[model samples]
Target: MVIEGWGVNENIEMVDRVAHCANKLQGWGKRKRVKFKEDI
Candidate 1:
């Protein structure tokens, strides 16, 4: 989720929202790559 909100949620809830999303995507991508390699 590309979080681009401003207010109590974005300003106070989390600091590095985009970084967090990127990290999660990286992890998910890594898992998918591993699965694809295994399948091949």
Candidate 2:
């Protein structure tokens, strides 16, 4: 379930747009969200 291909199958237009936007704003670290690990 990575954000490369499977995450953007096509039907999820909003997701694709957001991910693409994040890629561009990565330098600024503007991308929001906190990913947690099961082990943690």
Candidate 3:
């Protein structure tokens, strides 16, 4: 998941995309009763 050697804008976009996906998964887990414990 590391945005290695990427430009500033690209790095931000990558982070935003990951956050968005994580949020979606979090919501899905809530509905399905799946536990998503933080790994770090």
Candidate 4:
């Protein structure tokens, strides 16, 4: 389910926003991995 706008500028903005979310997800995954290792 992707919600995109109609326009070049809007598309760029959406991409940037999505990229930011992706970065956060990557960071969160790394943190979780470290915690899992510590638990083991």
Candidate 5:
């Protein structure tokens, strides 16, 4: 039971990390798009 709980915690942490990365990428993309528009 303890092992199962630990596994669940690890999965949650992984998901959080992926979500954080995705948000960062999205923000970066938005900034790039805006810059491109201004350059045109």
Candidate 6:
């Protein structure tokens, strides 16, 4: 899910941050038996 027209550097950084958070949340959800509407 890319946002349009962001600067390259900012986009890369944001994607990295989002990916990290998604991974963390996925791990937490798995432990808690939570379901997400969509996979990241």
Span of 10 residues, lowest total lDDT, candidate 6:
1-10
lDDT leader: 5
lDDT of 6 at 7: 39
> What local distance difference test score does each model get?
0.64, 0.52, 0.56, 0.64, 0.66, 0.56
TM-score of each: 0.62, 0.36, 0.53, 0.69, 0.70, 0.51
Superposed model 4: Cα runs more than 4 Å off:
1-12
RMSD of 5: 10.4
TM-score of 1: 0.62
Model 4 is weakest, by summed lDDT over 10 consecutive residues, at 1-10
Cα lDDT tens digits, model 3, 1-40, are: 1233333355368677677667766667686664444432
What global local distance difference test value does model 3 have? Answer: 0.56
Model 5 spans > 4 angstroms off:
1-12
Clashes of each: 0, 0, 0, 0, 0, 0
Tens digits of lDDT, candidate 2, 1-40: 1355334555667777677656656633432323233334
- How far in Å is the alpha carbon of 21 misplaced in model 2? 0.2
Clashing pairs in 3: none
Candidate 4 vs candidate 6: the TM-score winner is 4
Give all candidate RMSDs, comma-separated. Answer: 4.7, 8.3, 8.5, 6.4, 10.4, 8.4
Model 1 lDDT per residue over 1-40, tens place: 3443223265543556656666777877899999999999
lDDT string for model 5 (1-40, tens) is 3333335445467666666666767777899999999999
Question: Against the correct fold, how does model 3 do in TM-score?
Answer: 0.53
Per-residue lDDT of candidate 6, residues 1-40 (tens digit): 1232333456367677677667766667786664454443
